[model samples]
Target: MNTFPIIETERLILREATCKDADDMYSYLSDKEVVKHMGLEPYQTSTDVLEEINWYQSIRKEGTGIRWGITLKGKDVVIGSCGFLNMQPRHYRTEIGFELSKLYWGKGIAKEALNAVMSYGYKHFELERIEALIEPLNSASQRLVEKQGFTKEGILRHYEYTCGKFDDLYMYSMLKAEFELG
Candidate 1:
């Protein structure tokens, strides 16, 4: 299985998800406010959260991209999740996504987690391009990605179905070369 060692930052720990983390996952996933902008259903119960956690565990066996729970230093609670999705090995690229608990919003934790994950992709996975698709209405996420040096590629019309309707999305990308230069 692909091991996700704990990654420490100034104030957070990005680590693998464990079944024991179901409660933490439920804390965010079950909240409508947290999942409002995320393109997925709010988890209905801890059981649903556990099921999702199990799925994440299975992905490790495939040696592919997986999500990590973002935990604050000195605290056992998980405040968010960040990871790669839609991995395309042949293209040497993957889509990056993240969602944080509302309580931790605007604290720069998302950006820190994103930068760490991007660095891992570039250095360990040999990925050339990392892209983020943001709903046009999610200004916070757009700004976060931009600040992390992801250039706005373009707008994708009706790019995805979110919150029960088709939503326009902004595409952002950062190449390995660009990341290395900065």
Candidate 2:
């Protein structure tokens, strides 16, 4: 993870996120609909976006995880982001998370970007499992993972505490063997 990987797909580019992405990132993260199930409150200021960007930087330096800012091909504006976090290298596993602007909903951009990221994780990191913890009420996320060949392994009760409360999450996972079969 010394050099962040820039993944290019047919219609999108997943590049290292930078401070310059703060504005575009804020536009979506500040939206209530975008943050509702993300276990986060809508960011109210640029400072919040800075903290988010800093975390992205720290993860890369720490070799813990990496998130690429999602941009449309030929465009620099970051519409959303998708990547791994809570990575456990010793265990050969990590958690996947993503968010998109409401404006990009249903466009299949997420699927394309995730395909690239997940493939990188498996091939480069030699990951055995990539998992997602989706808020129970988020059907769209559940469907996205399902479409990607992830298996639903049932609910994890009170799995995380965020935004001032405990939340249950649906655990979905895709193993290297399963992804190879994809």
Candidate 3:
């Protein structure tokens, strides 16, 4: 499967991530506030970001997951990363995750990137469902998925361990038909 696709939105570009993007990606991944709810510690250095990009590339090669760097239309730096996770063609489903720089928060950049990704999943990948797992306290992520037409199914208790404790997550999903209605 062609896992890495360059998707463009009016204000954003979702392109395959690479080691060259380490510096730009590290700018956000190193911020505690940006990764607080994403179950990852702030990266201590750009080398960590480089390793992460390599891992992302490997997974895309294996057809398991695909992560994209989110860049502004006119900018050359990545402001964030977003993509499909645990892609299961047999089940026609995949989970989505995203993280944006705190500097770009509240600008709707995430929504723009996610919408493009989900549209690709439904149209090109023939996905029947797209899911999101949001920490209970991460209202912003919940709102992002909700705004994209995903319905909250329920909460998964102790869904993930992050920041030294087990965190509950709200499960949300949007079906292909639901996305088409929008």
TM-score of each: 0.91, 0.97, 0.95
lDDT of 3 by residue, 108-170 (tens): 899898989889889987999999999988989988888888999999999888778999999
Which ranking of candidates, highest TM-score first? 2, 3, 1
What is the descending lDDT order?
2, 3, 1
Top TM-score: which candidate number? Answer: 2
Any runs in candidate 1 off by more than 4 Å, and if so which? none
Q: Identify the leading candidate in terms of lDDT.
A: 2
lDDT of 1 by residue, 20-98 (tens): 8888889889888888778778998888988777766766566556788999989988878898877888899999989
lDDT of 2 at 180: 96
For all candidates in order, the CA lDDT equals 0.85, 0.92, 0.89
Model 2 scores a C-alpha lDDT of: 0.92
Candidate 2 runs further than 4 Å off: none
Estimate, for each residue in 1-182, the C-alpha lDDT of model 2 and write its tens digit: 36678999999989988888888899999999998999999999866898899988898778888889999999999999999998999999999999999999999998998889999999999999999999988999998999999999989999889999999999899999999999
So what's the TM-score on candidate 2? 0.97
